[model samples]
Target: MTPIGFVHSTRTDATDDAWDAEATTIHLDGDTFSPEALQGLDAFSHAVIVYWFDRVPPEKITTGARHPRGNESWPKVGIFAQRGKNRPNRIGVTTVRIVDVQNLSVTVEGLDAIDRTPVLDIKPYMLEFAPRGTVSQPQWSKELMSDYWRTIQSQ
Candidate 1:
């Protein structure tokens, strides 16, 4: 699928995990997606951005079990069990707060993608789409994401 837009952010490297501090601009191709496409988007407080992990090499794709982030402290688990970037399909999705919606561009916060990352699509955040039942995950998963979103200390 073709990317409808690309991200513009200060982050170029993937070493940092605190994404919440990142303020990104999704520059849509006006030739493809007109400014009218963003109508009513500003009404939403947040959105779900679907983007490509273009930086991830094909050799990094994993279908088998492995430690999350290669950290032995976390138990070895199937690729589906972890949110690692090295997936069969290098697709990344993140819910971000909408900072602004301008012509041919959307400014967002907390998008984990780096600068120049191809953005596939944007979906408005709907409460109905949230998990209906109690959400549960392993302690390791919690530890893995503890520092993912930027905390006051990280900023």
Candidate 2:
């Protein structure tokens, strides 16, 4: 599939967590997506961004059970159990707050992707799309994501 756009952000390297503060700009291909394409997007407060994890090498793809973040405290689970970047398909989807939408560019907050990441698609976040039943997860998963969006403290 063709990438409709690319992500422009200050982050260039992959980090284990803490992407909620990163401001990002998704620059759509002017040739493919015109300003009109972004019409009505401003009405939405959040968007679902589907991007390719191009930086993740094929060798890193894991299908077997493994500890999340390699932390022994976390129980070994299948690849699908965790939101790790190393997967069979290097695709990442994130729900980010839309800061602004102008022309062919969209400014977002809390995107986890790095600079030059290929954006596959963008969809508006709607309440109807959310899970209907109770959401459940293990305690270890909660601990693993406790600091994912928190600001890192300086030494």
- What is the C-alpha lDDT profile of model 2 across 96-130, one tens digit per residue? 99999999999999899999999999999999999
Per-residue alpha-carbon lDDT of candidate 1 for residues 47-115, written as tens digits (9 for 90 to 100) = 999999999999989999999888999899998888778889989899999999999999999998999
Screening candidate 2 with a backbone cut-off below 3 angstroms (N, C-alpha, C), the clashing residue pairs are: none
lDDT of 1 at 142: 89
TM, every model:
0.96, 0.95
* Cα lDDT for residue 106, candidate 1: 96
The TM-score of candidate 1 is 0.96
lDDT of each: 0.91, 0.91
Assess candidate 1 and give its lDDT: 0.91
